[model samples]
Target: MNISDQLSITAKGNPSKTAYIFQGEKTSYMELEGAVTKFASSLKELGYEKGDHIALVSGNSPYYVIGLYGALRLGLTVIPINPIYTVEEMRYILKNGDVKGVITMDLFMDKFVALASDFPEIHHYIVGDTGADVSHAQKLLNDKMKSFTGLMRTAELSLERPTIDDEDVAIILYTSGTTGKPKGAMLTHKNVYSNAKDVADYLKYSPEDKVIATLPMFHVFCFTVALNAPLMNGGTVLILPRFSPEDVFKVAKDEKATVFAGVPTMYNYLLQGGEAHKTDFESIRLCISGGASMPVALLKQFEQAFQVIVSEGYGLSEASPVTCFNPLDRPRKAGSIGQNIWNVENKVVDELGDEVPVGEVGELVVRGPNVMKGYYKLPEETAVSLRDGWLYTGDMAKVDEEGYFYIVDRKKDMILVGGYNVYPREVEEVLYQHPNVTEVAVVGAPDPNLGEAVQAFVVVNDTITEDQLLDYCREHLAKYKLPTVIEFLDELPKNTTGKILRKNLRDRVTQ
Candidate 1:
C-alpha cells in the first residue's frame, strides 16, 4: 500500500490528537491530514506533474513531514538534502537530480538564489516559515480541494502513473562517494515502507507511542525509523529542528515520549553532565541507537544511569537504512548490532564473496526487501554493490555462534561526528582550499562521545595560527563536519610509491 494511506487510517483513529509538537507550532493528526490534502491540491494546481522531483531543504518542522507525504501521495520522487551543505555540493545535487521544484525556509536563501542562475527548471518554489511573493504564497496556501481531507480526495493523485509498485523509486538519497563525488541511492517505496514496518514491529511501537523525531529527516535513519515508522504505526512524532542533548532530555520528559531514538554523541552528551535517573525516563519504554556504532562502555553507562536498556542497531544508506536491530523481548549482546531485521538474510563474507566463520571479521552482506533498487544514475557502482540481489556492505564485521553481529571496523575512512557522516576526503578537500597550508590530510580519530572525530594534520607553508585554519574550516565545512582536532607535522607519512598512508597517521597518533 502507498505510505500516504497511513494518514487516512490515522486520521480516522484519532483525528484530534496531536501529531507533531514543534517549538511553538502544534498540529493534530486531523489538522495534519487537512494540510497534506490542501498542499497536494496546491501542488497539482501549480502544474507539478507525477514523477517530478521535489526537493525539501528545511530545518526540523511539521512542514517537512507535510511536504514529504504530500509529494509521495502524488507519486513524486522526494529528494531530501542537508541544509548544512556548501553551495557547491547543493548545486551538484540540484543539477544531478533534475529537481523540478523546492520547498525551503528563508534562512538559507543565498545558496538557492545562486543556484537559481543555472536551475531554471525549478519552476515551483514554496517558502515555508519564510517570505515569498504574493503569487507564490497564494499558490502554496490556496486549497483548491473544497471538501477533500485525505489521499482519497485527490483524484489527480495519478493512480495510473505506470502502476507504482513497491519497486518504484520514492526517495533518492545522496551519500558521499569514495570517488570524491556524491552518489544517489534510489530507494523504492517498498524498501522504505517495509523497513518502517520492520522497525515498528521490532520496537513494538503502538499508536500511543510518542517518538522524538530529533534526527534530521534527510538521513535515511530519520526517514524510515524515526519518521515514517511512527507515521505508519499511527504514532505521534514530536519534531525538533536540531539536536541538543539538554533539550532532547527535556522533551523526553515533557512529552513523556515512549521511544527515544538517537546517535552515539547525543547519548554521550546526555551521560556526561546530566543525571538521567529513572524519573527522567519514567515514560521511556525503548532507547535506540543508530547512524553509528555505540561504544560498549557508553551503552553500559546509559543503561546503568537511566535504568533502561539501549538496543544498538545498524544499517546503511543503500539499504533504506534499517537492516538489523536487537529485539526487546530477546537477550541482547553488548557488542553485537543484533540479528537480521525483517526478511533480511545476513552473513559475513570474505573478499572472494565466500562466507566466513562465525569468529572471523568480514564484509556484511544482506538480502532483504529493504535493499534499495540501485544508485540513481551510477550503474557500475550499483552493480559492484549488488550481487544476486544481496547488498554487500563495506563494513568489516563478524557474527558469533548465536547469530549476533559485531562491527570490528569500517572498510571506508568515514568519520561519525554527533550523528553526521563526515567523509575524510570531503573535509580534506575543504582544507585544500586554504591558502596557508602546504599539505592537509584528514583522518578519523577515536573519540569518546562521538564514535569518531575528524582530525586534520597539516604542513604549514606560511605563518598561520591554528585558530585561523579553524575559522576557515568553519566557513566551508558544516558544523559537525568541521575538524575538532588539529595538529601540525613537518610532513605526512608516504610509502615508497609516494601514496600517502592514512593508517600510518592513525597509528602514530593513537599508539
Candidate 2:
C-alpha cells in the first residue's frame, strides 16, 4: 500500500490523536488529513495529475508534511531538495528530474527567479511564507506563482484520487554524485512503505510514542524513521527546524519525546554539553544512531550521561534507506549494523559474486522489496547497480558467524562528513573548474567531531590563496562538502597509466 493510504488508515483510527507537534502548535490526525486533502485537490485543480514531478524545497516544518502527503495522494513523484543547496545544485536536480512544479519557502524566491529562464518547463511556483511577505514574492513570480497558505484556505477538502500502482515511483532521491553529476534513485511506493513498516516493527513503535524530529526531513533517514514510521504507526512527532543541543533537550523534556534519532556528531555535541547530565532526558526511552558509524566511546559515554540506550543502524538512500537496525529484543551489538531486517537479505560477495567466508571482507549486496527500482533515466548505471535480483551496495563489509555485519571501508571512495555523503569526485570536479589548478585530488581526512573531513591536495601553475579557492567553492558546493584542509603539492602521486593514486593521498592525510 502507498504511504498516503497508510496515513489515511491511521487518521481514521485515531482522529483526535496528535499527529505532529511543530514549534508550539499541535496538529491532530483529523486536521492533518483535512489539510492534505485540501492541498491535493488544489494541485489537481491546477492540472497536476498522476505521474507528474514536483520538488519540495524547504526545511522541516508542517508545510513539508502537507506538501509531501498531498503530492503523494495524487500519485505525483516528490523530489525533496535540501533548502541550503547552492543555486546551481538545485538547478541541476530540477532540470534533470523534469520537475513541473516547486513547493518552497519565500526566502528562496530569488534563486528561482535566477533559474526561471534556464528551465521554462517548470510551470508552477508554490511559495510558503516563513515570515517573508507573500505579496512581494508573488510580484516577483508573476502570474505563475501561487501562495501555499492561500491554496490550503480556499481549496475544498475533496479530491478525485488516482489509482497509484504499488510499483509506481514515489520519490526520486538524488545521491551525492560519486561520478560527477547526481543521479536520481527512484523509490517506488512499495519500496518506501515496506521499509517504513519494517523499521517501525523493528524499532517497536507504538501509539503512545513521541519521536523527536530534529534531523533534516529531506534526508531519507529522518524521512522514514523520525517522520513516516511514527505517523504510520499512530505516534506523535515533535518537529525541530534544525539541530541544537539546547533545543533538543528542551523539546524532549517539555513534550516528553520518547525516541530520538541522530548521527554521531549530534551525540558527541550533546555529550560535550556541560549540562547534559542535568538535562531531563529521562523521558527518552530509545536513541538511534545512523548515517555514519557511531564511535564506540561516544556511544558508551552518551548512554552513561543520559541513562538511555543508543541503538545503531545502517542504511543508504537506495534501500528506502533502511536495511538493518539493532534489534530491540536482543542484546545490542556495539559496532555492528545488526542483522538484516524482516524480508531483506544481505550478504558479502567477492569479485565474482560468490559469497565469501563469514569473516572475510567483500562488497555488501541486498535484495528485498525495499531496494529502489533503479536510477532515473540512467539505464547503464542502473544495470551495473542492480544485477540479477540484488542491489550491489558499493560498501566493503564483513559478516560475523552470528550474522552481524561491520562496514570496513567504502569501495566508492565516499567520505561521510557529519553523516552527510561527500564524494571526492564531486568536490574534485568543482576545484577543476578553476583555471590555476593543473591537477587536484580530494580525500577524507581524520576529524575529531565530524568523523571525517574533506581535504584537497592541489598542483597549481599560478599562485592562489586557500581563502580564494574556498570562496569559489562556496558558490558551487554545500557547506558540509567544503574542503577543510588545502595542501600545495608539486605533483600528485600517479601510476604508469597516469591515474592519480588517491590511496596515496589518503595515507598522506593520515600520516
Candidate 3:
C-alpha cells in the first residue's frame, strides 16, 4: 500500500481529530487532508506528475507536512532538504536528483534565485511565506517563484491518487557524508510505511497520544517517528518551529503530550535548563532517543529528572531510518539499542560475513523490508552497500547473550593506539559519567610515537580543570583508552539533526 493512503485512512476514520498543532494553531485531520488534496492537484495542474522529483526545504512547520504528504499523494519522489543548506550543498543534491521543482520557505529564495540559471532542470518554485517578512527579496524572485498559498487557493479540492507500486521510490534521503560526497538513499513506499507502522506498534501509540515534534522534519529519524508514526495512528503532533526549551515545555504541559522524540543533545539541554526541573513532565509517558547514541549516564539522568521512560533506538538512512529500539515491555537496558524490531533481522558479522560470537564486537548488518531499494543513480555504490539481501551498516557493535545490541563505534572511527584498538564510545561513556561534564566527544589524533592518540573535547557545567577530568578518565579507563588531551568547548558541533560531527573534530588538526 502507498504511504499516503495512511493519512487518507486516518482522516476518514476520524475527520475531526486534531492532526497537528503548530505554534498555537490547531489543524483537524479533515482540514489537513483537504489541504494535501488541493496541493497535489496544484502540482498536477502545473504539469508535474507521478515519478517526478520534488524537493521540500523547510524547518518544522505545517507547510512542510502538507507539501510532503501532498507530493506523496501524487506519487512524486519527495526530496527533503535541510533548510540551512549552503548554495553549493543545495546545488549538488538538486543536480544529482534532477529535481523538477522545489517547495521552500521564503528564507531561502535568494539561494534559489542565484542558482536558477545554473540548474535549468527545476521547472517550478513554490515558496512558503512562513509568517516572515520576506517582501524585500520578492522582487528578485518574482520571475519564477510561485506563492504556496496562492496555488492552494487557485486549485480544486479533489485529487486522483496515483497508482503506486509498493517498491516505488518515495523519498531520496542524502547521507550526511562524513567521509565523501553524500549518496541519496532511495527509500520505497513500503520501506517508510513498514518502519512507521512497526515503530508505532512497538511504542503502543494510541489516538489519545500527543507527540512532541521538536526535531527537524528533513531528518529521517523525526520524519518517521515524530511525523509519520503519530499521524498514521491518528494521534496529534505538537510541532515547534525551532527547538526552544521554553516552547517545548509549554506545549508538553499545555497539550498533555504523551510521546516526545528527540536527540541526545536536546535532552542534555533540557536537563541543564531551569524549566525541566520545575515543569511537570508527568504527562510525557514515553520518550524516544536516536540520531546519536544517548550517553547511558545522560539517559539515566534524564529519566530520573523527568520521571519518564526513555527508549534508545538505532538506525541509518538506508534502513528506512530504524532497525532496533529498546522494547517497552522488556527490561530497558542502559545504552542498548535493544533487539531488532518486528520484521527485521540483525546480526554482528566479521569481515568474512560470518556471525560473530556473542559479546565480540563486529560490523552490524541487517536484512528487512525496511531497507532502501538502493542508492539513487549510483549502482556501484548501491552494489557495495546492499549485498545478498543484507545491508552492511558500518557500525561496530556487539550483541549480548540477552539479544540486546550495543554500538561500539563507527568502523572508520576506531582508533589504533600503537597495536591496541580503542573504541571512542567506550571513552565517551566514561566521560559522561562525570557529574560536571555536560557533553563530550572523543576522537583520535595523530602522534609522533603512536599511530593515533585518543583526544577528547568536553563541555562542562561547573568548575573542573583539564587535569582533573583526565585523572577521572584514568581511574575508569585503561592507559591506552584514556584521553591524552582534553579540550573544553561551550558545545560540540552538530548537524541540523543534532548528530555530533566527529569528522569536523578530526579536520581541526589536519586543516
Best of the candidates, lDDT: 3
Q: Give the alpha carbon lDDT tens digit for every residue of 147-205 in model 2.
A: 89999989998988899999999999998654579989999999999999989888989
Question: After superposition on all CA atoms, how large is the RMSD of candidate 3?
Answer: 1.3
Model 1 pairs in collision: none
- For model 1, how does the per-residue alpha-carbon lDDT over 281-362 read when each residue is reduced to its tens digit? 7788888888766666667878888878899999988988888898788878886899887787789999899999879878
**Which candidate has the highest TM-score of all?**
3
Model 3 TM-score, 2 decimals:
0.98
Candidate 2 stretches greater than 4 Å from native:
134-136, 274-278, 414-511
Per-model TM against the reference:
0.77, 0.82, 0.98
Error of 1 at 48 (Å): 1.3
Which is better, 1 or 2, measured by lDDT?
A: 2
Candidate 2 lDDT at 364 equals: 93
TM-score preference between candidates 1 and 3, better one: 3
How high is the lDDT of residue 72 in model 3? 94
- Evaluate candidate 2 by giving its C-alpha RMSD to the native, one decimal: 10.6
